[model samples]
Target: MRPVYAISGGVSKFAKSRPDKNYQALVKEAYDYAIKDLEISFPAFTEIVDGSVASYFSDHFSRQLMAAIMAQDYLGLCPKPSHRVEGGGATGGLCFQEAWKSIASGHMEVAAAYGFETMSHVETWKGNEFIALASDVSFDYPVGGFYSGYYAMMVTRHMKEYGTTVEDMAHVSVKNHINAFHNPYAQKRNRYTIQDVRDAPMVAWPLTRLDICVMSDGAAATILASEEGIEKLEKAGAKIPRPLVKVTGIGRGTDAMRMADRPHVDFETFIKDYATDQEKESQETMKYYQKLWDQGTRYPGVHSFRAGRTAGNMAYRHAGIHDPLDELDFVELHDAYTSSEIQTYEDLGLCRYGEGGPFAASGKAFLPGIDYGLKLPDKPVCPVNPSGGLIACGHPVGATGLMQAVFAIWQLQGSIEKHFNDDTLQVKDAQKGAIHSHAGTGTYVTVSILEKE
Candidate 1:
């Protein structure tokens, strides 16, 4: 396989509504940003491109099909081979990896991956109803399994099993919103307090409005190129940024769409058969799993995401990451809600399975030097959601995951300040980072490792 590098990326402003432009123009806006960052003309940069991959969540939202074809024509990539990818919320992440695969498989030297979602076309409730269709129509959707209720149910189980408190979840909200305060592209940039979070209108018992990510209208694009492709672009007057972000590893996992259809393996079998080195490292960690078993806690009952764990495990192995909390500089995961961020910490091996709550409350996953106003016990270990994640940055489904890639590229390129016009959120001396995208009660999850090269 050939090596792949993400040379540049762009994002449109994330907001509840973008009536000024259609989806095609929104995509072009982001694509233009990426090309402009390379100090190259639009036609000049396109001259080196081999093909492209398009990403979007639902035709129901846009009320248009063949969207990718329209985008291809709009971007002037006519007749070049291109396809669209959709996997619930992981659409953009899947698109990114697909573009990488095109290069890695020697099919294309350079590929463009772009994703967008204009959810504001429908009423808020109508949009949610459309999103709920991602679940099993036979069981989950029929029973009114709205996404928030499903997440609320899962987090409640997490609270019951792992002693994860609403306060723990609130800490996550505060941290992410605070981080978004420094991000210019984020949709919700309010620096909220724990009280402010807790006081917000309740959606589901423990999850308030602040704890949930808002649906957004946005687009994101990234350029992936091989060594030859980079040289070709450079020859065409594209000033690619220094410290290129290389795609070292990529992994994905999927599970049953229906929650009840999921199988529950015993904890002992889980640890012995499938656990990774970091997951089963110490006797203390063994005891923790054992205690959960002793209390009749089974593996991956609605409380946890087995798919997320599998994705992280595969990506870490490919990236040669044995100790994620130590080796990686930061992580950008699908934080559809604050609780999921904590749950993902455990999934990604940043913390143990049950410690996700404490991990958030400890401030270990927080960005340091930025006063979150909440008195945190632990210093920063591995900052999660430094771009405010989906909760603060906004969840445009297709654009959400690619937004992560764009931010990761900028972070590794040390251009966060140049992009956001703010240096406060950049991880200091960042060398490697992970971007995780999750979909529908962990039905689909994608994890990729990006590093400076």
Candidate 2:
């Protein structure tokens, strides 16, 4: 019932890695960009909400969430209310949720939420160990099982049941890489062919190096205000952007922390069973048709907890969207792997449960020749990852959630430049757009839908 609003949002360029800047410096750079990008002066907001997943990794009380504290210091609001939120990869989105609730409840009139993580500063061996440990201890970590292994199990199962092939998996990476080619902020812009993906070095069995999202350093921020606070800011010197991308809904859900702990009848099992069905259909259909629907088949044993779909579904419910496949316009989802994007299409109801691969090949998801132009079957299901996701944009765990929020807001505001447009292109503010995030290996999910007034 409480209406939440965003006045401005911004993000630092997403890179595969940045060794030049330390954690604090990286956050400072992102905060400055957010402030200037929004055209807000130093004295704009009175409260700050910060978050980070790796502050524990950075130093005692030094994760990325410290960005709020850092921003307050930079803004010289030394005594303003500021706090941290920690939800592993979902930290940023949760931070935005908390700030929105604060304003909606009349606790804070104006607030700023910012997040960033410099994962490159940490050693990969230690980081991998830590991430692996975040899963269930007795079942997942004792033997050194990690996300790669866990997802590999799922992929294998899917292949066994669905009869999907490795070629199907290759298409996922190829689709996302081609989309990323137009994004200047993307970490890796090199285009990949289906053959290239098929030939790429395998990371776990079916999944290849290109299938994974690159770990990197980056930050993002958003400023929010209640209607009354906006009036006051405008009365003073701040130039709050008109027509706020208001947060209409927020929803979150949690699954078994580790797949090994998941009940045999749980959603994880359901997805695997579904993948198996897909394989059977592909095998049966491939004999008669060149493509299952329009694409090749994939191999199973690569199941991933799609946090974005779960979160996005919740946000859609709160925002009153019952038919996401038809009603929504564009999306920014966590593409931790190429398969993630394809799976999310099914999970989010954008495509039939196992038809996601064919959906990608339909030339209907994205506008042809336009980079980042993923669409719905007809109009372009609100362009997907227009800014490039973790696959193209680097994955900075603690900062990912907030980065999603920032990117969604930017897309809605038309602040992001479309790479190619000979004609005067105008995207009317999206009536409904969603941000999806996941944390702890898809163990946690959060979705938020934003709309224009």
Candidate 3:
């Protein structure tokens, strides 16, 4: 895969809102940023793929629905085979996959993939509904099941079963926010404490506003080229960028949309055995509280766990990584919520089941030199989500996955260190990194591994 496709250049910038720029302008901004540092021509790209969701939310958004074609004209990359790829929040990852396939199959020499989303134009409720549309409409949507609520249920169960305290979850938010302070593109850069996270307004029980990712408007783009394409450009007297990172492995998977369809241990037994002090209340009070507990204990989406595990397994197999905690240098996973990040640690094989909370709370997940109380891992088990992930950097749905890829490419290229001088924020001499994205209520999951060439 390294010899087949290389990420030559990439760009990503995000904000809470971009009232001045629409979807096209955002895409153009990222495209320009990506190409500005490279000596590449528009004609050199044989294919173009656009990854966007909710384009209608942009101020001057297109009604044509042909986002890829519209983007080609906007960027002046005319006559090339251009198309749009979408897999809910993993839209950008799918675009990258398509670009890789095009070049790997010998159908194209060089391809460009870009993703954007303009979500701030609409009201918050409307935006929430739009995101909820990605879930199973027949089952999940009708029951008022949004992402936060689904994740809240998962975290609640994790806490009840594994003794994961609220403080453990708050630590995840704290660590990511600390990392975000170093990222210029992050939506929220303010440092926070466990008390602040605990005091924030609750969006869903056990999940506060600060615990979830903010909706944002942003864009990202990446240019991928084959070895033959690089040689062709060089032979034609074109200057090519040196030290491009290669795509070493990629894996994708999907799971059932209905949460109940997934295989999971019956958490009811755990709840019964580990009943909290609430059980000591009066009989009437206990009955009412038990009713509430019963309502909240339903398995939300075990598919999320299964999907991530499946994808990670395939990626590890392809990359020949038997022990992710030992082999990988860093990770940029889908931290849509802090709980998701904790769960991902277990799912991605970074730690054992029921141990993700302790692993994260222990400060092992934080980069080196950051004093967060607990001692860092004896050997750092891949600093997770150093980009602040979707939690603080914002989740623009369509653009999130590509942003992860861009971060990995920069990290592997050793270019991230140039932007931040902090040793904790830098992953020096990083030869391998992995990026993961999950979308559509766990209906789609993608894991991509990159290596420095």
Clashes of 2: 37
Ranking by lDDT: 1, 3, 2
| Clash totals for all candidate models | 0, 37, 0
Query: Candidate 2: where is the Cα deviation over 4 Å?
Result: 44-75, 163-165, 264-310, 371-379, 418-429
| Residue runs of model 1 more than 4 Å from their true location after superposition | none
Q: Over all chains combined, what TM-score does candidate 3 have?
A: 0.85
lDDT of 1 by residue, 260-279 (tens): 98878887788975576876
TM-scores for every predicted model = 0.99, 0.81, 0.85
Looking at candidate 2, what is the lDDT of residue 273?
40
Q: What is the C-alpha RMSD of each candidate to the true structure, in Å?
A: 0.9, 6.4, 8.2
Give model 2's TM-score versus the native structure: 0.81
- The best candidate in terms of lDDT: 1
Better of 1 and 3 by TM-score: 1
Candidate 1, residue 182: CA error in Å? 0.9
Candidate 3: clashing pairs of residues: none
